[model samples]
Target: MGSEKQGFIWLSGLLFLNIFVLSTADVHYYEFSLQESPFTKLCSTKIILTLNGSFPGPEIRVRRGDTVFVNVHNQGNHAVSLKWEGVKGSIDGSNELIQPGRNFTYKIELKDEIGTLRWHATSAWAAATVHGAFVILPVATEDYPFPAPTSDQTIILGEWFREELTEANQTITPGSADAYTINGHPGETYGCSNDTTFEMQVDYEGLYLVGVINAVANETMVFDIENHRLTIVGQNGTYTNRSFTNSLTLAPGQVIDVLLLPNQNVGHYYITARSSSGTHITNGILRYTTTTTSF
Candidate 1:
């Protein structure tokens, strides 16, 4: 009999495409949300800001020879300015400032480094919300010399505000303390029944390779999967934490990759992530089914 431990079942629906597998040449341009929050929690915060909404927006996982384009659309009340000067490759540092209801495009070619990275607004007014992750995976054709997952999912942790961003920034006094949020809101949303709505969803079941990117707050997240095993991968895109277990501190701009093997049986499960602050953010789902049967 094959050892269950030896069989790592992966969900490929979320997997990168073959064209992106090891292709030395590819081009992709992402759209940035200057108006709407990429996350749903903002629905409760009732706060609308200049940020994209997702803690770290979508992970741009690509291989070598990829050209990335970012089209930023300004939807907020304040004018948006992005100074890329501090960004490693940004020579001038200042990309064009996007005005309200306007858009701008940022283009760059990928080098050979494979790791996680972030793109944030240089503007003081925008940095509070305009942040996301940029990931460059090793060339696809190259053999990954590790126990990798068959499928993957992403979890983003950030703060949400219902109030207008302009109002929040103006009210925050220069010397006063600033509140850090996870997913979008603070601890949880208040409800009349005392059942404050808080927390995000994590997928349960099957084999899942998960990536959690914290964009705004510094959090030590504990991911609990019911009856499953987990392994930690790359951190900060450079620090390698291989095959380990324990809730680790993930500061802003950090990414954690873990593999999970769920309890046996073809079913569904929820992957849960909770911040040390007791804040809940994003959620992902996993479904298991026999190959002999259609999903």
Candidate 2:
């Protein structure tokens, strides 16, 4: 009897281990680097911050309800802060501080909603670097509430400054706009420039979603996707009836997802974002490259 009991216990342990392994295999993992780099001409010196050595670190794409694990490496001299601006008040929520030379892991069980999201830094020095987007899609066979496209892509918008945010904010008077960035960098370096190219192919006529994140403090942003009809999907990742037809006005921390209908006579188009207040200009290109492609 004792031998039989031990055998049963061992079998159960193995079964549990198998289950754990299978579950782990189902989830996806992504890693990113946080370093410092340059942004502009006026602030032509080196400013340190957490990023993938550039502005707008990287956009991570995953499925709804899929588990995500992010390994954060802090290469800076000071501690880093990571904040998630997804579903509120949960593990995916924002505002976390990560120490320097150390690594931390973040696990998020994505909700069953498909949209664009952002991971921002909560540290004082992190206002510039340590930012990126996450594009979450629905499961296969699931239909999007908006029109479907032959292919889709993500575009991240930001304002890049040459100096540290702390110094910029202090030197510039309050209620003044002094930020710079588009996509992820100020001068179009690191793929954040207003001239970076974006290409995609569409089936017939359909809607394409473009995500815009306003990372600055108080400036209102305006975006122009040349020759395309645009409709606002959601603000800050939440659905809203307050949709704009052509241009969008975005304040800091606001996210705008736009549904675009492309023109058949497409060669290459420039999707541009600028502060409605004339602060900065950032741009991305949308080109009709192929028939069926995934981004």
Best by lDDT: 2
User: What lDDT does candidate 1 reach at residue 149?
Assistant: 52
**TM-scores of all predicted structures:** 0.63, 0.72
Write candidate 1's Cα lDDT for 1-295 as tens digits.
3555344323242244434543557788777767654333433343445455554344566654467777777787767665332134552325556788887777766654445556566554356566665666666566544555566665555544444456336332221213334333343333223222333333334456666666553455555454456677665545265776745457545677666655445565444455556544333344555423348
lDDT (10s digit) by residue, model 2, range 1-295: 9999999999999787545543533478877767665544433555657567765677788765577888888777666667777744367423465667788888876654457777777753466556788777755555666666545556565554444565334233223434455664443433423333334455435556777777665566776767777777666655555365767777667777777776546476766677676655655566664344348
Q: What's the TM for model 2?
A: 0.72
Once superposed on the true structure, which residue ranges of model 2 sit more than 4 Å away at CA?
A: 1-26, 38-45, 92-96, 165-179, 185-207, 238-244, 264-270, 283-295
Q: Go through the candidates in order and give the C-alpha RMSD of each one to the true structure.
A: 9.8, 10.1
Measured with C-alpha atoms, the lDDT of residue 268 in candidate 2 is: 68
Clashes of each: 24, 11
Which regions of candidate 1 deviate over 4 angstroms? 1-23, 36-47, 50-61, 81-88, 91-96, 122-129, 167-206, 218-222, 239-241, 264-270, 277-295
